[model samples]
Structure formats: structure tokens, C-alpha cells
Target: MKESVSYAPSRADFTGSPAVAASSASDGPSVKSLVAVTLGNGLEIYDFAVYSFFSVIIGHLFFPASNDYVSLLLAVATFGVGFIMRPLGSMVLGNYADRHGRKAAMTLIMGLMSLGVLMVAFAPTYKDVGIFAPIVLIAGRLLQGFSAGGEVGAATTWLMEAGGHSRRGVRVSWQMTSQGGAALLGAAMGAGLSHLLSDQQLYDWGWRVPFIFGLLIMPVGLYIRRQLPETHSTTAASTVANPALTLWREHRRALVLGILLVMKGTTTFYIIVYYMPAYMVNTLHMPASISYWISLTAALLTLLIPFWGGRLADRLPKRKPILIGCAIVSFLLIWPIFATILYGVPLGYTIALIAVDQILANISAVAMFLLVLETFPKAVRACGMAMVYAVGVSLFGGFAQFNVTWLLKVTNAPMAPAWYLMFCSVVSLAALVAWRERHHDE
Candidate 1:
């Protein structure tokens, strides 16, 4: 029942020895530094999520196929394609972060993310460039995917390393909080665009506005990231020719279990936060604006919930209790939530139900993230987190929308997403139960 792999930290495992005393003396990173790191992450997520928010128009624009269904499938597939490069990005950038420094890796990814957004923001239409239109769009996604692959790992590792041990849970929890903020900002933009713009106007240019906004703020992120203190020391282990090999050889169980542990969160997030807008518009015939507003509301609630969860993580003796509780509750409630939404419940009630689910999912997700962060020793922390996060997201989260779209077309089952989430929940629960806990703090 017990796993052989262990991650007991040594003195070198401290992210940076100099910062430990300073961090422990206070709560965590200075507000300015914390804002810089989390803000960059939020912008990256906004750029990524904006694509899904406007997938319908994006489909009609760049992917222009014979039918609407095929066009949308192609559009979402392009979205998923970006994820295909995540693992590679994680390996390259994650390794770079480990070898160079967290500050260096964070600064580098900002430029790459900006470049990818530029391509999508200004790409020519299918009508203007024919095949080259989609080509440019996909190329942009690939670049974004690559940049993002290493982004989360480096950012989370930095927070963990820079913050005090007692506050690590709340510190790492900001990763999820930033994502919620991204979704919140993205949804507000979507809802506003949908409300203010006509169909012709929205399809013509409204979709590009968010990406352009992301580009405008990216320089600020890059500048701020450069000013942050380095969290990773360039030790001899970091200079290893092949950190990934060492990760696999020494931490195989953690990698495997971590991937499985991440599956439910990624799948649920992409489906609920990204795919639901399309599902409501396409399947239920709801107005796009209504879906956007609903998503906006959920994103707002989710944004505030993670801090509480983070606090809970800090208060608990072990993270497993909250993780298991949330998983089991989510598994039981998912089908009913979807059923209620489909059964013509009041729109207000529907929003409440979605908010409830998001709250539960987010709490568990925060706990899971903290657990994974502690599972790897500092030497390979960035690489390990990047690999686990990127692989799980690329394989499941990246394609969740596309898969559900295909399922609806084939099975015509409105509950398709619920079923998919259920299966993922079972897998996550199994992994959680099997996981051997090591409370590094304790």
C-alpha cells in the first residue's frame, strides 16, 4: 500500500536559502512581487481562454469548412492542438527554469506568450488568405501552448520556494486564484463584446479585442517578472545534462499518480469554464450573451473561493481529507447538476448550481496542487510540476471541448460532459486513495 518513492526535503530543498528567513518573518512574497507573478499567469490564461469564449466565431472565421459542425470541430481541434506542444514546452522551459533560475524562466516565457498572441490577434481570415489563415492561427496556438507548458510549473514553483513553509498552501493557491481571475476577466470581455457588438461586428473583429488587450499588458508582465528575485539556486544538480531522466528514474510513482490526480481538475475546468458557453449556445439554443454572463458569474464566485480553500489547506493536518471529500461530493452531484440545467430550471437557479459545483471542484483542486507541489524535491520541482501539469492538461483538458462536441454529435446525449466528468472523478478518487501521503511540513 505504501509507495517506495520518497521526497523528504534536505537543506538544499529550500527554494533559496536567503529568502527563507525573510519569507518566514512575514506571510510570503511582497505584495508587489506576488502581483507580478500572479498577474502574468492571469494574462496568459486570459489569452488562452479567450479562444474558447469565442470558438463559434473563430470557427466561422479561420476554419470555414463545408458545414457549421465541421467548422467548429476544426476550431476547437485547433485549440486542442496548442496543448499538444505543452509537454515539449514543459520539458524545454521547465528544464531551463531549473538550470537557469525561476526568474529567468518566467521572464523568457512572457516574450514567447506575447508572440503567440500577436499571431492570433492579427491573423488573416480564411477568405483573405485561404489555407494560410488556419495555418497561422494554429501556429499561434502551438506557440502559446509551448509557452504555457512551462509557465505554470515555473510560476508555482517560484511561489512555493519564495514563500514561508507555514504559508505555502496559501501561496501556491494563488495559481488557481489567478486562473479564476483570468476566467473572470475573459468572461466579462466576452459578455461585453457579445452585448455591445452585433453578429457581423463580433464575427468581424470583436474576437480579436481580447487577444490584443493581452498583448498590450504583456510588456508590463515581462518587466515585472524581470524585477522579481530568483528563487532557484543554480546548483550542480540543476546542471545535469538530463533532468527528465533523473525525474523518471527517481520519482516514477509520483509522476504517474500526479498525472492521474490532475485529470479530474483539468477535464472539469475545460469543460465547465471553456466548453459550457458553446454548449449552451449550440445545444440549448441559448443566446451567446446569456452563456457568457453565466460563465462570468461562475468565474467570479470561483475567483473568491480558492483563498478560503487555501486557508483550509493550511489549517488541516493532512490535505487528503478535503481532497477526498470534494471528489466524492463532486462525483455525486455532477449528474444532477447537469440534469437540472437541462430540465428547464430557472436561469438564476442554473447559475447557482454551476457556482456550487465550481466551488467544490476548486477547493479540491487547490488541495491537489499543494499535494503535488510537496511531492517533488526542490531539485526537480519545476520540471516535475510542469511535466505532470502539462501532460494531464494536454491529454485531457486541451481536448475536452472537442471531445464533448464529438460526443454530442454522435450520441446526441446532452449529459455527455457529465459522464465524462464522472469517469475522471472515479480515476482521480482512485489515485487519491492510493497516493502515499508525505507531509513535508509536518
Candidate 2:
């Protein structure tokens, strides 16, 4: 929807992409500083991703529609509530990061996310409170969403701002390690616990335990984030400048391109991390255990892509890895990962395909945090990142499950949703390819 960027591309700024050097107060980002910041950013992701894995359980507890499908929709919509509020959180939090300090923003966002998790863990279910059950869930997700929105931008930018030269790709790779690890850990608990619980017990109180445990991780994430260095200075001059306005004026083209690029990441994550779990269990009749286990393994394995992608970002034109990875995803997008699972593929095949799919997504995904951070100047960077990211996630990623579920219901065909995901993939890739950004660093 936004215009593509138009500018002369920058040259590759690093060699061999070893660990990058940080910006000296006199210089720019150094490699060690980027690595440290990324490590903290990774923990922030882990704190939030813990929610997505519990979608089905939450649906059963909070939103109890008579029909199972409707319940799923409601639960996801509740989840999307968090996704929807993220932009507002990002706008304010991003401003705070740009004005106050990245370290403060990281700590604040992570702390808020932890509070949201704790609330959800303690919330009474529909069985206990009638309509208030879902209301509470919605409120909790919004809080989580707000915090998560800011955390990604601030923490990720912290890493990019610090990684002055080499290994930017490698450092950025840590950003997603949290994503995979969170999914991996949450899935293990959800699937394992579900297997142990009586259906009644699970539907009743079993679900809250995981969320309660998620709260415990907050202090840890906060502790790590607190230890990371503040990557940028929010001087009065930069603070007074309206970054959103500045981005619109000077970096308009890059702003549009960045938003479109983010759409892909948003789409891919929902489809894999959020939507696939239900699809695998409901449509393919794959054991839910298999779905969760595969996700766990995939997330753990791909944790290194940000680091590797950062290398690519520094070594090649950022555009090369960005476009190439997105292009591959375009081809792979047309087929649903679970389409073959319906054919009764072996569990091993199912797991292998999921792993490979996640890997492609990882490679495609890792270049983004740095790409967006670099797209804008430091002054308006957070605003530019937050605005674009908020819109993409709200429209494309947040409503993902509902969209796919509706697609399946309308077509009355099993293969319809797979094609739908493919359509989204094509659309996403098209935006990337058609982008007008003149940065030849690709």
C-alpha cells in the first residue's frame, strides 16, 4: 500500500562479516556491543512468544463458544487484540526509546510483558466469570501486545545501532533465537502437559499453569536486558525532532519499503508459529504432539539465522539476502505445510518438512531488523519502525488464523487454506520484489 523507496544503494560496509565493532562515543557501533544487545533482545522475544503456543488452550478456557471452530476464532481474536494494541504501545514506547534511552525502553517493555503474562495466568475462565472471562483475556493480550511492540524495535535497534561493522548479520540473528526458543519451550510444555491432563482437567485449569510459569521468565529477561548497554543517546536535539514527521519528509520511500518488507515477516510468523499448530491438529489429523514437537525442534535449530543473516547483511548487498530469501518464500508459500500431512506422511516426514520450511522462513526473516533500522536515520528510526511494523502486524499477521479458518469454511475444501497461504505468500513476495528502494546494497 505504501510507495517503494528511491535512493542510490549503499555499498557493503564490512568484510567477511566477523563480529562487528561498536560505535565509539566518538566512533559508531562495535561488534561486541551488538552481540550483547542482541542477546538481550532475544530474551525479550522469548518472553512474548510464549503466548502464541497456547492459543487453543486459551480458547477453551476463556472463549467458550458452543462450536469448536468459533471458540478457536475467538481465542485467536483475543490474541490478536494484543497484536492490535502493539502499534500504540510501539508509538509511545518507540518515542521513549528515541528520547530516553534504548536500555530503559527494553526494561520497561519487558516488565510490562511480564505483568501481562502474570495476569493471564491468574485470570478466571469463562466457566467462572461469564463474559468477563474473555474481557480479561483481551485486556491481558493488549498489555502484552503493547509491551512486545516496543521491545522488538528497541532491542533490535539496540543491536543494529551497536553493530557498527562486521557480523551485523550474526548479531541480528540472535533476535529470532528467542522466537524459536520460545516456541520450542512453550510447545514442549503445552503438548506434554496436554498429554498428561485429563481432557476435563486441561479444559478447566491445566492451561493457566504455563502462563503462570511464563511470568517467572520476566525478571530473568529484565535482568539480561538491564545488563545490556544503552546503544543510542536521546539528546534534546534528537528528542525534539518529530521522528514520524521526519521519516515522512526525508525517508518516505524507505519507510514504505520497510513496511512492505515487514509484512512478510509478520505473515510468515503467524502462518507458522500461530496458525500451523491448529491447522496441523485440526485439518491434517496429525497428532497435536507431532505438531508441537516439530515446532520445538525447528525453533531450536534456526536460532542461529539472525547471526548468519547479519553476516549477509554486512557482506553482500542487504538487498541480495533480503530479496533472495523472500523470493524463495514466495515459491514455498503456495503450498500449506500441512497439506501433505493429510496424506498420512510419516511423522518423520512431517517433522522434516516443517523444519525445512521454518529454516527458509528464518533465512528470509533474519535480515529485516537491521534492514529497517538502517532504512531510517537514528532520530526517526524508532517511529519509522514502529509505525510500519504496527500496521503490518495488525492487518496481515494478527488476523491470520481467522482469515485461514474462514477460507477453509467458505471453500468447504481441505486444500483451500493451503492455497490461501500461498496467495498471501505471493502477495508478500510481490511487495518485496516490486519495492522501489534504490539501495543497491542488495
lDDT of each: 0.80, 0.64
Query: Model 1, residue 359: what's the lDDT?
Result: 91
- Candidate 2 matches the true fold with a TM-score of 0.80
* Candidate 1 lDDT by residue in tens digits, 1-442: 2223223333423433223322443646865576677776688678766776798899999988779989887987887787899999998998888788889999999889889989999999999999999999999999988999999889988988885565666677677878888887886787689889999999888899999998998888889889998877787844555667778998889888999999898888878777787788889887876776666766775677776676667667577899999988888888877787688777787777778778987788778877887777667778888999999998888777777888898999998988988999999899999987774321
Q: Give candidates' CA RMSD values in order.
A: 5.5, 5.8
Question: What tens-digit string does per-residue lDDT give for candidate 2 at 277-385?
Answer: 6788887666675676665556666664544554455565545456656557555734635556667767777666666766666766666665566666677666667
Predicted candidate 1: what Cα RMSD to the true structure? 5.5
Off by over 4 Å in 2: 1-57, 64-72, 126-131, 196-205, 286-294, 329-333, 336-354, 434-442
Q: Return the TM-score for each candidate structure.
A: 0.88, 0.80
Instruction: Give candidate 2's error at residue 353 in angstroms.
Output: 4.7
